[model samples]
Target chain A: MPQTASRPMKVSYQDLFWIFFKAGMAFGGGLGILAVLEEELVTRFKVVSREDFLTYYGISRIVPSGSMTALAVAFGYRLGGFWGTIIALTAMVVPAFAITVLLTMFYQVLKNTNLLPWLEVSVLPAALALILAAAIKLGKDVFRPSAGFLLAAGAFAAVSFFKWNPALVLLAGGLLGIILFRSSQGEAK
Target chain B: MSLLSFILLIFTFNLLTFGNGPAMIPMLQADLVDHAQVLSIEQLLYAFAIARVTPGQANVYVASIGYFLFGLSGAFLATLAIQLPGYIMLPFMRTYERMRSNAWVGRFTRGLTVASVGLIFAATFSIGIKTLGEPVTWIVFIVTLLTIVLLKWNQMLGLLLASLLGILLKLLL
Candidate 1:
């Protein structure tokens, strides 16, 4: 029972935008966006409590999209109404968007020079490492020792080997989960 | 490419995406590189590199793509399209709370989560095959893997160091 869910917290749109915008620019990155927000809002500024952040984050994960943006929306709805949702989301997005665009523009300038190629090619392996890290982290969360391993392996094979549509593979996994991993086990599965 | 189809593509990816930015990479790669022929793998990976240099999620890296294809308007539209899913889903979440605890939903989410992880693994395999051939890349790769994954350091630091290493490796052996 987090305090956030029970008692409403008031955050001005100006505060929401500036807080999230600065958080965006801060690049407080060890984990996903939600963790970064927890750091910026809860840990740093004391805007929200730790318990509240985790509570919203948990609910956001359980939601269908499961993206960190969902958590942004959750915070928005909690802190303000529909407009708050828009402003908060915009704050989170604008920095990343602006920087990406500016860099791409700079990339055009770098094109006439020699650094562009190294910058592009040399960075892939590093980027790939990050992607691999993400996979390993997410993999550890979703699969158990034995039974869940098979499900993950099966999904991987379907996508990489068989060239099945990822959407279809996900749909099939959902169907199988309903059929196979029911609540009948009694304990948390 | 038609702007409408491009928007549809962004929307489709967002709708199906279950995790964060990295998890969505393979699906975006499939469409952009293999299916729709919007970008070559190298070009897409370049956008990815530049994207990593920035702060935050860097969601679709479509600004570069949209700019490449259709200029500024395309960039704006693509950014909006990528964001649309989160906004669209927000109202439903606010209005309805029962969807949160349904056991059937729970089962569905478990399946989805596991499969999303698998897709990410497949993505890593595919990208690793194409990249990771050079010594510079190998050094960058190992260092990034150790720092970001093992040490739990911010990816921004890994990327910044990688860029510096790229320059150093170019000047040296």
Candidate 2:
């Protein structure tokens, strides 16, 4: 693991606010904002290397919450302790939340009009496209040529074809991973 | 359902739907139709359609539907419920960071990633089947998929183009 020799700089609350606020501004959804965040924090600030950031990003998704939010929390804690976490999470979420609320309100008022449904029909394909793009990107990372691809395929089949409970499938996959990847030294392979 | 029940339901729904806003749809439909009787199947479908076309989480559609059915209070409760889990859990995410170095946890996350991918793929198939039922719809779906995969077009652009094609086909053919 590459570590910066100098102590972590003291990032003020305002700096924290701006960092996350910029992230929120650039936020397009999926890995897009993360790309911007990597450029700004990892590349510009030298906070962490690209490999370290990607590793964190990948691991963050597997945890039990929103990956972006989890990343914000992690980044904050890493830079500034508890207060850093608070500032980072707030900066990341507040702008987006406000925008979502305004958009939702506007949508509610305009929802019954004749044009809205037409607009919806128009945009639906894009949503599908976005999903496909995200899936492909994630697949590139996780779908190594090994058994990982088979595991992903099995998961897709179970959910799409059989409509099995997602939670159960996830649990089973995790257990399978442990059994398959555990090393002779009892470490995860 | 009563306001309290509605709020509780929404909150619980958010808590369990872990991936993103769209993941909440099937669960929301189950709760709304089977348990709460808050929405009909048609209304549920409409809500989902609206969610996709909009820029935010599909869960936000719950607010509009709630407001339409029950009024301002319903909207407030619905919105609060949807956001509560993420908001409440934000503070404790720090504690979660402490455990990241654990090897077992790493393996667990690796497994979970595979599962998450599976879940998203399943969602894609299910949504695709229902939304793209007609021959023309299938054509539009294929075209859009190819555009994204081949042309490397921005997804928003592909969606806009596909939607226009959909409407044009509906109007002309």
Candidate 3:
């Protein structure tokens, strides 16, 4: 990895707010945020270099909490330091929070009425299917006909069949991966 | 559940889990639903749907739960609980990078990432068995899965189509 030790461009709090606010509103999911951030932060404004941004993103994935939020923190710190971190994170988070709460209110209105069950019947399967698709995609991406496959499959069985707590499964899987899949490179393949 | 406990629960999970949005779903469900009983599985499914349809982090779904349970204040609390600890730890981003290439950390992260998929699948299966009863739901499920896997459609668009199909099915049948 090429480490660029250059000073960051000075971005105003308002500028950071609107930039990430736009990103927050435009992108719909965690992965999509990367593209939008690249466009706005790297290609468009040149706030952060592609290498640094990607580095932050990689770190974000390894740490706990939401990946996007983690990105916001790192990117924000890169842009403006501690206060920048706060503003950038707020910008990124507030839009989604507002939207979710609005929808929750809508759900509340519909919850007590006869319409709630109907909404559930229609939405739940699609949501489940999306998740199932994600699982399949992840398996295809991760499994290489080795111990990785076995670990993933075993984790699945533990969680699905045995009703094991996911946190515990994840902990055990990490330990197993350490013991079994050592000497491997990172997740990038 | 008390507001403080809710915040503590989300904060604790955020501090611990190594993976991203979908991975947190199962843990959140296990805590808020199975353990706390603050949210029913059905309500949790609806919250998951709302999170799916909306923008930003999927943990916004947990904030939605807080909103549902206690209104705007609850939403703020929950979002803060989940987000603040991670943000505060932003200074440690460099620290994580230092340990990034460590053998054990790499193995742990790989394992955690792979297992997260299974945990997400577990969540999906649990919800699927309970919610996907109607034939129309099955149709939506199949169609959405095919649209995503075969067509390589965008996820937000896929979710929109699924939501519309759900509404249409409810209207038609």
If scored against the real structure, what TM-score would every candidate get? 0.61, 0.61, 0.59
What tens digits encode model 3's per-residue C-alpha lDDT throughout A105-125? 888575554544665655556
Any residue pairs clashing in model 1, and if so which? Answer: none
Models ranked on TM-score:
2, 1, 3
In candidate 1 chain B, what residue range of length 10 has the lowest lDDT sum? B92-101
| RMSD (Å) per prediction | 7.2, 6.5, 7.3
Tens digits of per-residue lDDT, candidate 2, A1-189, equal 113225567566787778777665442243434544654576457775543464455445555555666677667766776687778766765554554444445654654655444543444444455555555654565567766578778988998878786667777876776665565322322
Residue A132 CA error for candidate 2 (Å)? 1.3
Docking class of 2: acceptable
| CA displacement after TM-score superposition, residue B26 of candidate 3 (Å) | 17
Chain A TM-scores in order: 0.51, 0.56, 0.55
Compared with the true structure, what per-residue lDDT tens digits does model 2 show for residues B40-143? 77666666555444443344566656665676667656765554444333444444345545677556556666666766667666655555555556656667
Worst 10 residues of 3 chain B by lDDT: B14-23
Candidate 1: where are CA atoms >4 Å away? Answer: A1-84, A99-116, A183-189, B1-78, B91-97, B151-155
Please give the fraction of native interface contacts (Cα pairs under 8 Å between A and B) kept by each candidate.
0.53, 0.34, 0.64
Candidate 2 residue A159 C-alpha distance from true site, Å: 1.8
Indicate the worst ten consecutive residues by lDDT in candidate 2 chain A: A1-10
Candidate closest to the true structure, highest TM-score: 2
